[model samples]
Target: MTNFNGFQKLIAIANEYGIICYATPEECLVASLPGYDDFLLAFSWSGAFEGEPPEHELIAISIQDITKEVTVAAWQIPTYLFGNVLRQAQMLVTAHQDFVLRTNNP
Candidate 1:
């Protein structure tokens, strides 16, 4: 079912932002942001009836800080809202990377 072109397109979009994603044997999509190892995005889909396949998906983002031993989770997100959420996540990661670069250079 994940062979759908749309799925591939989503993977491509993630890759464009330096996010690596793969499908698990159970069909869940797991993504990781390069250079920001603390954040993870996991996408899962349901609502398949009679093998008709699901038209929408759910997303969950997990953020962990090992130094502080804290974990933040955002889950049960609909795909319709994923675009904005993804963009925000990307911006946050980019900002963090920029901060790291500046601090290391100074």
Candidate 2:
């Protein structure tokens, strides 16, 4: 079970990657990133359920108006790897945020 602090770290990471992360009652985390012109990378994740457990997966979608394109990538990570990914993402976000901050500051 992840604590609030951990979740906050995840959000920070997403922000750094120029992605937006939102939480829904049904979905644990939803991440979205705009790519190129209209293309986008959207991903959602659900840790575990009450009765039946679901696998941890990542999905990437590409939107191109009428010609819609989609790609999916799913994988299961061990409990140990979960923290590492989360931390890495957080580090990326922190670095991105720092870069932007420095660039904007005179």
Judging by lDDT against the true structure, name the best candidate.
Answer: 1
Q: Give the range where candidate 1 is weakest over 10 consecutive residues by summed lDDT.
A: 46-55
lDDT comparing candidate 2 with the true structure: 0.42
RMSD per candidate (Å) reads 7.1, 12.0
Clashes of 2: 0
Candidate 1 local lDDT, 1-106, one digit each (tens): 3556656655655566556678778665677644556666655543333644243554455444334454444455545555565666657656655776798998
Off by over 4 Å in 2: 36-71, 76-106
What TM-score against the true fold does each predicted structure earn?
0.44, 0.35
Error of 1 at 35 (Å): 4.1
**lDDT score, candidate 1:** 0.56
lDDT of 2 by residue, 1-106 (tens): 2456545654554566556657656434555433333223333332544564332222222222212343322343422234344334344444555665798995
